[model samples]
Target: MEARSRCRLPCSYYMTCKCCMKRMDGKGKSFIRRTLGSTGFVQAVGTKAGPNGTTLVSTGLSDLDKIIGGGIPLGGIIMIMEDIEAPHHLLLLRYFLAQGVVHGQPLLFASPLTSPKSFLGTLPGLTKGKDSKGNVDLQKSGQSADGLRIAWQYQRYLNEQKALETRRQRQQEIASQSWASGRLHASSLSPNLSSSVTSGSLEYTGTFDLRKSMDQAMLNAVNTVCFSLQGETDMAPLHGQCAAFVTTHSRSVQEVPNVGRIAMQSIYAPQSMHLFSEWKMLSFLAWLKGIIRTANVVGLVTFPASLLKPSVLVRLQHLADILLSVEAVSDDHKEMEAMLTDYQDISGLLHVHKLASINTQVPSFPEASTYSIKVSRRKEVVLEHLHLAPVDVYGKGSGNAGAAQVLCSTPANAPSSLDF
Candidate 1:
């Protein structure tokens, strides 16, 4: 019995023998074992590695991207609560689709409008040779010729020259510091690093011109699919389309990963609201959230929050990875005019409700929850921090100040005024 017991292998020996061999092999023939290279994961255009190793795709608006903590992550859904009175949500949808088109990413756009394809024609074109502020350099455009011809422009020209000289000196100092820090030498060693930096600086997120439509040739080159939700009786067909689209661009099917964008405009618009039940709509969102969570796709859905019940709206908000709401500012509102310094420039207010917290526990909070959205030069959409107008002590121009004083002043008939 002792001999038989000794000949038999121990229970742990059988269980750990292969693991031990693997550990030994791992230590000795490390070179033989394959390790994922830098190029192992294909990076799609318009996408960047974000915090916590998450992949981020630009929201098309650079300011919006900054506000939302870099960009929207892959496999995430961005829900924008629409302003019922105005078509402000379309501005966001257009930019999102246009950016995808610019990056050569596949786009699936669905809208409740009768002819969704016609909406593509309204997409903003990429502005070439524009600075980060989406402004063309006046000097480069020969607009300085008028200044040269005028006698009064001499002082202005001298001031401009002084400013240019100061800028040049500052740039030279920065370059010298970079060289001194050995960063210039390190950057020179990696050709791709320099190339990527140049490309990123130039075209990381395209600045779009709202006045110009995308070139026909450029639009034709892109693979775009548009769907009209006008006749759809239920959400099943649309859900299927989304699923199929996601499946086509899924990581498992692609040899090289390519990002896909799905934009749905006015999901709960009155025109299509009758076609879908509240539960059905909720299910569709839930299903979409599930499918996109596994695939290399990002989705944007804009819906009229005013049309939906509070409970349903809350559920929708919870499902969204990022939630944003737009409120149109009334031009005639004296209070608003008095409150904002740039009242004429402001078109609407953008509220950041929830930011995407994918693959992480910590949530991203913007420096300010609200930003003023306005058109710059009537060409580009600009988002700026809301700046309050200076308070007028005399209450001459400030309507809000006058109203506040009137409210604070107690009436003679009031009990509080009579006693204290």
Candidate 2:
């Protein structure tokens, strides 16, 4: 009988094939390596690295990262579409910048329209423990409400919970190191929605007050990559310049070895829109997308969907890997409350047009989520799924109504006394 041999791949050149890996030349090998390289310089921006090897990076909003796939992949672009009246999107931008600074990652903030400093000021001061708005004061220290002399049962329960939390946080610290030390994959959140680590996910290192001058070292680091540009029409050339600058920083042993994080903020603002013609804007983004995929770079851009025509925004949406739109909840608090009656609290609907690179291996990635950006004290900045009870009662209120009826069923009493 004749000896037979078979090759399974459609094409031997298909990357990742064992035979291909063996035969691959220097460039091919490098391509494969880069494809698998971890964006570990930054940690817990919300997403894990993909198997394809493109570096996964954080937006500096761990909450946002969790909602939008594993976090934005390096070489990926996020088009944050904000409302005309609402500036909540700016909060996310500040988080991104602050996150970069904290991680000591090289960041490029190019804003043709807004005052970079004023916008940067919006970043909230980093704190140790932040819970639901009302509960923050309670959980100020590691052991919240410590001053209160509570009963043993409740205290013991708290002790058990605290112990569990401590163990989880320890796990998070270990996991965070994986991403920081150039390991690509990470569990974005510990068992809880929030990260358990010390610094914690998306936590800013320090506060920035306009009254006080910025730190010398922090200022210098930001200055190295931040570009305050003029003459908006053609920024494609400037794109090349920025990429080169980032490359230089990443290679320099003197600077922190960080992955490049670029924030092309408000590119559609009036200051720069005229500079980029319809096709010119598209061309620039296309070039940008290519750069991020090949290099250790991830970009975040804000475009006012209101300013540009829908068609133009659609074109941009196509170019970007993820597109998020924010709308104001309502001017009237009562109106907002009435509108989102089912939810305990909701800021606005976070319409996510596209979400890619979901890590299915991780069970946290929900099959169906009513994604929203809630109005909370701490976790309010990014898009979060409106956390609801698994068994939604839908306002039936039978138990409460019965209790009320029992008390109120007595006939109307005189003003002096009513039935209890």
Candidate 3:
């Protein structure tokens, strides 16, 4: 193992640099902030940008990305609290994991209800028979060798076998770079990106079966562990084990050859009451915040908010960098809401209770901006602005409309939508 150099002052800490022997002046400090912030600094700096410039990772849903101002920022801890039991909750979780798999981000599943392997089995395959985050080789028959020769068929078969073996070797190389999501290299197509396909823009997509084993190389690049609640109540050991798991993972990340460090997130969904206690759980979550900020890993957990005490929820809410809750709505309610607003096919209500650093103490993404989610066959999980689509048949009152000439109306080129 190579011995890592230890610096007296860590730029991230805003401390004096002992090696430099000179204080980083205001200009130097500003530059460091911009660099770190842009790379997903865990610290919140102001109301507009996250404490730091946020490194936006795709939520795997473009619409959702737009609503949240461009995907979940790396180093963020998002809690999905549910007021009521809802199927959308499960779907959302699937979308989150599926997105990670598609991007080839390493996933660490820590749930008693669903084992990582079993949950993956239920995931749909990539649409194009290939993993979006990685490539899948297609088999092709080798050309016939010397059709006149008796050994031609055998030679062709051997050639085909060699090709398959080579492909396997290549796949192994890809898998070894487990934490390298396509987001890093997907832009290699062109430098003028706006005119072309943005990774988030709708394009080719496919299903990925989580149940199947990932490439051995990819598997080696990450660490995945599951904590099966042994029905024991001692929280100390469980807490230590969980914390150790995260700590070790963070440390090992340094060994991988990655463009940027992959953000770490531990997904925990307690199946029953025996898994964890509120106090211990709170402590575990608190410890998580430090790891998230210092190590630059994100934390995602699904908790039954209603089932837990309000105090616990409040503390967790404050501790988490981001909070989200799914509001279950029936089909009839969906239609009712849709008729009143443009929320057609409303799956459920998604509440953005708190968004850290955006006003710090209050929700700031979109105030009073109703939000709803809907999914597509292509695994497009949309969390868009909810609108009411009123029915106005016979062209009586179309939503997309043009007002007739009014007494004080401005000319075509002038501003008319609103006036100062």
Candidate 4:
């Protein structure tokens, strides 16, 4: 009676005692049983399992990944609308390719240039330090000659420190909970998770230094296939090549799965536009999209939006799962200069038109749709929210000069610490 009340059953009689079986199984046993029959997902390097059974790969930029609701998912197409005057799209392409190289993933690079292989040489090398701060250089430490400048800069520094501390504490709490729950065990966890505890770690996405080129040895080790669309009169040959590449990386039960990245730079540029009609180009894109949809591959295509007609551009945008556009900021644009406080630091603007929504109905919306693209002193690309310049009572220029004068004229040397 005591054993029955405790719901303890012998192994031989386990089937007869439903209550005992349920008590012994626990939640972990149920999870294990559910997954036992299912074919496990590929847990490759530089990839993580996202919500809704989708796998995510980094876009080379950590901030960009966060903005796009965790990295780019496998089997999705990313389209970037190019700026007519600037090569900002190339920055995105370089970073995307560089990330694949770092992860040792197979790459298929197609470009309108005669020598697509040469573009690989210009890829930025990964930054040495593991710190994410390497991407943003804030001149916050040194005391400025101006009192107001010193106060304002230090205040910004304090705020950044607080943010970092809060983030660190949150990460620690998450790690503790994951460990306590035992939901992610060594045997159950994917190689992607076992290798890296947290997705935010440096192993997942690396910071790159734009000033330095990747090491020659590292570039030589990667399996890179480059195709030149400089003078190809027919889209058939390119389409065939892509088909073969996708076949090599297709998901299969027999073969060990690996991630593949396909990058097409300026696909509809002037050089290639003469060879194929708009219909042919659209057909090619549709075909490419179909092939990559099933395979464990992600494709990034950049085209000059200004050259295409509105109807054609709309069709192209609709084809992309993730759509982004870059706009160059003119140096002499007085109106923009007056509107943004950090006008001098702004190089361009990044607009996120769409985000990849795979295996789910709910669309992911970022906190901001537009972000300012800034190049740090170390040549690292950084994205930040645009801050409007402060307005005065008269609605003229920033009233910083008068405020600085008033603060500096105080009898006591500026209050030692910030209030907040």
Candidate 5:
């Protein structure tokens, strides 16, 4: 084990740096505020402009990346919605992970729902297939490949085998930890040994350790996506009563002031459950905020909006800055609230934040396409309640009429944050 350095912290406290890492300024006072505020700082400095291939675009979630820049932050939380079985969330995650792999950035998925073989194998960039000799090779099957993807089956097999072996060894260690205590008799450990032996025989092909695997993968080209359901039982749906019931049942598992290092969430809904409520949007939003800050991961939550009111839909829109309403394309839009809004003008530019019908159809990309709505900071609107501007839909070019490119109209006397 590496030796930890000792630091003279604020309040004359001498703490070891190993367990409780401290960030101190030149004067030696605690920089807790600064460190906590750094998240916002890192977000403001967006990813650098480069070749289009270098950037990882997301499916429509305008304000999401604002908290962590254009791409997911290191060790950040990511949610995927599986309610409609659209796999949109998984596809987007795979795209980001593929980009990360190409760029040497690691990714981690903390849930067991996603299968690396079948789910991730579909991605063009990261998916590795094989040749006749069972050697690693690239799939040049189509123009979408663009000479970037490893689409061979044998190569994928090799990678899967390697991952399996690694996971098996790690699991063995964890499973055998009881041996260290010497508290259990051989007979008592029989069941445990049997389970371990059986598990090892299964040939762990994918990264099985959701938490640890994700942590380590984030340091490299590995991208992990965790699978978790978002609602309750089918009969009752996740209504207020159900939420309250679950909350009561889960009170013991949840802890306040969670550790910053771990991506654990206080609230979770299994796939077998259903949610029902008019204020469902508000509850979901509050829960999402808690999950985001607590889990420290990006997530994609899915819920039915058919029974919700227009006010609830609007609240949900605000709650989730980046909304991907599958209903729009799934023929459920008839019952759901309107997603498109009237176009507005900003500083002589046409700002299309609320679109009535930009297009009901999904956009196409060469491989897989992900839409990113980069939302700016909240700005006050005149002659009406203040409204936040959405991302710059158009490319960031001069004279672009997108919300991002155009500057907000300033009052003659009111000072602006930019002025300072």
Candidate 6:
């Protein structure tokens, strides 16, 4: 039979052809393997390597990654766009936790955005413990359900045990190898290690103590902590409470006190929190800067994209290492095109392992490893906007256009450049 005709036949014909081909080729497994090669096997069995180094995986949005370097670093921040604290943002948080669990790293997620329940609900391959009556179990489901929390708790124990075992093994290997006049064996034992395994993840935790007050030591432990609140308020409240938060606390950061330890307050008011005057907003940010001294704590404050004035935002941009802007995915043609372009660039930088962009139409970002979707159910558009010129967006040239600044200049927030 012709090749095309044979291929067109049912299971019986394919099986007979396969056996005959294998017999003729002297192949053991199957004729398909011999014909297709290694690349075919790779495609069939989808196993890809995890990210190397401290790579920041973006949320497949270019503008988002521009400010925050793809997404946030593994043991770093994943800024949330707080809009009544939705489930999708919570899902993204769990994704971060999953990455931490698989790679054996601790994750620190501090948000006033949503309650912990919203976050617990979105974890990938994770669920809450069940009741006595056989409910959806969370703590112990004999699955990877509690992987994130378990990984965090047991990491120290594992590290200590591994270190002791490694030392003992090394000593034993040294003793076992007999010296031929001080010459070791040709095949010596060497432990297999990788760059990440050696460097290890940073362990900086944020523990809330109501009585102790916010201090330097506590601040040092927290790498990235976000303060999420409402935005778009009237003129009076903005100046009143917000102004008080700045004048009272922010002013304190500037003064030098001869005491036990300096108190550092974290104040985050996202634009979504509520509407406030430009002056009030600037004062709040200035207060945040005052609290961030020679400390490791990465302070994050969220605000609405709509309310921010360019002049005030440009000034605020200098206070953060990474700036993240969040927008709801839009259906407008021009906006969609912009979003697609941003998504493609971010996917390239973040190097997401698996990505799907689902919605009205999938913009062809062929080179991306991540997925993009155009779904109607309110998707968050996150961008760091790494290549965007801050000057063009918020600098003097642009006369305060309605276009919001997602992230601002990094140099503005540098410790040396900061004005205390």
Give candidate 3 regions above 4 Å deviation.
Answer: 1-51, 129-222, 230-232, 236-238, 249-271, 334-338, 341-344, 358-363, 367-369, 377-379, 391-420
Query: Number of backbone collisions per candidate, in order?
Result: 0, 8, 21, 0, 40, 46
> 1 or 3: which has the higher lDDT?
1
Poorest stretch of ten by lDDT in candidate 1: 12-21
TM for candidate 1 is 0.71
RMSD of every candidate to native, in Å, equals 15.7, 14.7, 15.6, 13.9, 17.9, 22.9
CA lDDT, candidate 4, residue 108: 95
Which portions of model 2 miss their true places by more than 4 Å? 1-48, 114-118, 128-219, 222-224, 229-233, 249-257, 333-337, 342-347, 358-370, 378-383, 387-420
Write model 5 residue lDDT over 1-420, tens digit each, in one string: 111222222221111111122232123334344433333211100122111212212211222232223433221233332334333334334434433333222233322233333444444321122121222233223324533565565566656766775564454444333322221232233334233222211111111211112222322223233323233332233334323323332323433211111111112233232243434435655664454433323333444344345675556545542343321123332211121121232111111122111112432211111222211221211111123334345644343323221234333355753331
The true-versus-predicted C-alpha distance at residue 299 of model 1, in Å, is 0.5
| Candidate 6 ranges beyond 4 A from true positions | 1-117, 120-281, 331-420
* TM-score preference between candidates 1 and 3, better one: 1
TM-score of 4: 0.71
**Cα lDDT for residue 224, candidate 3:** 45
TM-score of 6: 0.30
Window of ten residues with lowest summed lDDT in model 3: 41-50
RMSD of model 5, in Å?
17.9
- Candidate 3 lDDT score at position 19: 18
Kindly list the per-residue Cα lDDT of model 2 for residues 1-420, writing each as its tens digit. 010111133331132222332323233344345534342322223323344444456676656766764567666788888787887677677767766654455667777644555545445434434324324554675344464666656877877877776565454444344433332223221222222233343322222222333333443444335555556446755777776854553433323334567887777777666766777777777877766655556788887788998898888888877777776665454423333443445556565666654233333333323356654554345456444333335964333433233213233353532343
Encode model 6's per-residue lDDT on 1-420: one tens digit a residue.
333332332332222232223333344444344443322111000011112222233222333333332333321222333233223333334434433322222223433343432342333331111122222352146235545445777767856865765564344333222211111112111122111111111111111111222222222322222222333244444334333333332323423211111111112344333444556656655554444322112223443333455665566555543443333333443323332444333321221221212111333232322233222222323323234323433435432222222222223356742222
Taken over the whole model, the C-alpha lDDT of each candidate is 0.72, 0.53, 0.46, 0.73, 0.29, 0.31
TM agreement with the true structure for every prediction: 0.71, 0.60, 0.56, 0.71, 0.29, 0.30
Q: Which window of ten consecutive residues has the lowest lDDT sum in model 2?
A: 1-10
Model 4: residues with Cα > 4 Å off, grouped in runs: 1-41, 129-202, 391-393, 396-420
